[model samples]
Target: MKNFKILNNYSIRSKLIIIYLFCVLIPMIVTNSIVYITIKSNEVREQRITMEHAIERVKYNLSSVLDDCVLVSNHLHNDITLNDFITRRYDNLLDYYERYNYLLQNNVINYYYNSQHVYQVTIYTDNDTISNSSNFRKLTSETRQSEWYRQFYNNNEDMTISVYYDDNRKNYGINNTARTISITRKLDNFDKTHENILKIDVDYNVILNDILNEKMEDNLYVCNKSYILFSNKKSNVGTEEFDTIDSIEEKDVKLNDFFRFKVANEAWNIIITANEVSPLSKIVERKEILFGLAIFNLLLPTIIIILVSHSIGYRVTLLGIYLGKVENEEFSTIEYNDGQDEIGKLIRSYNLMVLRIKELIEVVFKRDAEKQRLELAKKQAELKALQSQVNPHFMFNTLESIRMRSLIKGESETAEIIENLSALLRKTINWGEDYITIEDEMLFVENYLQIQKYRFGEKLTFSFYVMGDCKGIRIPKLSILSFVENACVHGIEEVSHNASINVSIFKYDSRLFIEISDTGSGMEEDQLNLIRDKLRNAEIDMLNNSKSTGVLNTYMRLQMYCNNNMQFEIDSKPKEGTDVTIQIFLDEPGVSNSFVKENQNNNF
Candidate 1:
């Protein structure tokens, strides 16, 4: 359990190596070792059994071949007719021919010719009256000097096996020296004759062919003690005299097995020397192939495991890095090519979560900013109310007294001017309402323009145009009056020539359009664009930092009133005129008197 725990602690790559060693490499080595030992042992044992069977077969065939020759020789020796024919005195060649034809009819040699591998049957005798033909031969000086006859006479037994080369022989019509193996016996069954001998030649090629038929991958020798009587290799069969088995031994032949048997009173040996291949040669020859297979088995799996483990571990590590970044509040998405597997799905889900979180954070931040803006607007409203509370009753009474004094002094135009000034000051000092109908706001605009016209005299000309249906549309207080004040101060006061100011409030397509334009020494493009940018992007914070608080405040309030469904545009040309247009959809969502009322109650 402790070892298992330690193994678990190791990385996946190391664990895979351990698994290969134990599961594949070690087991394979043990299995191959056992298989090699068992196969080698079985191969050696099977070779020995095979060699034994082969040698035994060669011995049996040799014995059978020789036995057939001896059997034929025994028949000739015991035959009364054959004995009488060879021993009888013949008067003429015709009588001998007639008797020889009769003997040929019952010849045992003809019966055993193909069946017993017999080549020929010859009866040799020193009977001078008998003629020599195929079956009967006259023994002469040359016959006595032959190797077959010599070997037989030297054995000095009643019967013997003789193997020698007959140089003056023809086999199958081919004149060549051939090896002859035969059984020679003295025909003494019941005879009173000279030396009658029977010789039955066992076909040497047939015997050699029998040994060759074993189909063994080994060198075989059929030997008579020291002389090699037969060999499976045709070249090894003796030409003139039989070769000795000791010559084979001298050539460093590795003869490891022998089968000895008796045939015709002579011990013959079957010697087997293995071919150039070892019994375990198969294992030796395939050693390199086996080693390569082992390496392929080990290395292939190792590489596969490493690739699989790296693929998994690398993706998991990448996820870990992204997770760390997320923990640090870095809401960045995973910029990776995704797969269809479980881990790839996880990464895609994480990206989606990051996107949703970022959206929610933006919503929360916007809500907080709105709250701060409302609070600041409320404070500024309170400050304006406080500043407006500076002895307003006394100031009004003093203005009334001066206007009545001017009327009593018959300066009627002076009294009207003082009255307009006093009324304008009173309306400007009041902060009782945040939103009023366009009709009420236009009255305020007229008062402010009246005071400006009095200051500019004939140099300024101003007019107000309000559509019939647009008069009752509610808007933020001072939203239009602020722009009119800017026109009077910048346009009418700066120009030496007569400059005209126009204020138009009209409705088209359910939208309220308020346009304030002035014909005066118009502003440069840079100043116009600056002011336009300021008004378009107006915020509560600009009220504190910007010198143009009046215009900025008016734009911000109008935005809040229309719920940002308001558009403000500025069009101007140098030395020509300036135009400011604000378009708002009156019936849009949240663009209603109740929406402004709620804001007013909350702030005031």
Candidate 2:
């Protein structure tokens, strides 16, 4: 009946508003996230297509370079110097080259292919044929060599390609600069001597260089079976030794023989590279624009949604606040702005909480009044209870002896700090009253800091401010002390920079405030969130949870005595620092019984 009465007391409109808010909020988040992902997917697809087109271009260009070499061979075979030089001597080919200059010279292929091998018209008629030039005048049998006889002539092949390096003569080596490929053939109606052999070497350097010219901005490089010719982002060519199966400098690069991915008709492995314009960029840009617009479009509704939800959340927060304040006599009523929304209904429910509070107060008052009448009888019982207790004075005496011994051993600071701790504990734990001076808490804290001071040396700095006669005011136990330990462990432990800690206690609005701030290695929003989550779920039995749990466990114990009259707030940022303020009311619930007897004794 009482629970039904409690439910009936709150306005009906609040429940409907809460239902309406959920209807709007859930769908809005899901739809916006979906739209963002869709836009990103399309961008990725477009980038892939761009990458494929680029690969095709590299293959076509390499094919054209190979084709140019074939054209040069066809033009040379029809010339007379090729035949005349083999039959006679080097002098016999002079007029033939003059006559066939048009056929031999291709301005399009000449600029880079301008080396002697590409333009020189030479013919070797037979195995022993030697030119009558000054360089070949004394050519012996050992000096004579035929590239055509070994590679193309004897095989009766239509054509053959060979790469040759004559180390002894230092002559007629294809891509003499790099030791490369050349095309050769045997001519049938040569009329040049008995040898029907014709040898032609394609200048591979010229072809490779042509590719470098066209893509003036790409890493247009060639990697033979042995090494890679490199061009940097600036198009400067150099050589890079190949040690691995391969490594790619830029993404989507083609390494015909280097890559392990299945290839299509893959001779002449080509590598094509680009800088600012890559497949990834195009894909990302296109998708970003599409989905970026989608996400941008979602912002308006999102803002409205946040404002509405926060309003609802704020009302709930205030309701919890009102219930907490009513637990003490400090606040007896909850007044709020009128509205027909769900929050308005909640405020109405809160208004009826006043009646619940009134009934609780009456029950407690009647109970206490009866207890006062029996207080004389309880005093007799308390005397009996005291009679059975161990003497706290004896424990303090032992601790005092330890303090004196440390002092005698020349540990003056250690002795002084321990002496203070002994007194703080004796007064707080065994005191007859629940309230103690703020000044007394400060003394305990200062003594604790003094012990830490000797350990940290120069790394720690502290400040303390006390107000409202820090004496005779009861408080939640283990409130400020735990945070001090937390500050030292988390804040100062990892800091490389100079560190300082400031602990200030004061009074505002008839409340006691203890703000402990640390300057050390600060934390980012994400780190701070993770720390808070660990702190909030900690129960009193947190020692069993994990060894790392700290301030949160102490907070659970404090909440038992002070309830929500104590407020804990944390503010932190990356590389900045952390501030934890624990605020408590000086008087609340049962002020006399709330404080541990230890703090009260320390007050005097």
Show model 1 residue runs off by greater than 4 Å: 1-39, 170-177, 234-242, 250-263, 275-280, 284-604
- Candidate 2: C-alpha lDDT: 0.56
lDDT of 1 by residue, 504-565 (tens): 98878767799999997788989888887887666777888977677778878888878889
Candidate 2 lDDT tens digits, 369-404? 788989888899999899779777888998899889
* TM values, all candidates: 0.40, 0.31
lDDT of each: 0.75, 0.56
Identify the candidate with maximal TM-score: 1
For model 1 the local lDDT of residue 325 reads 94
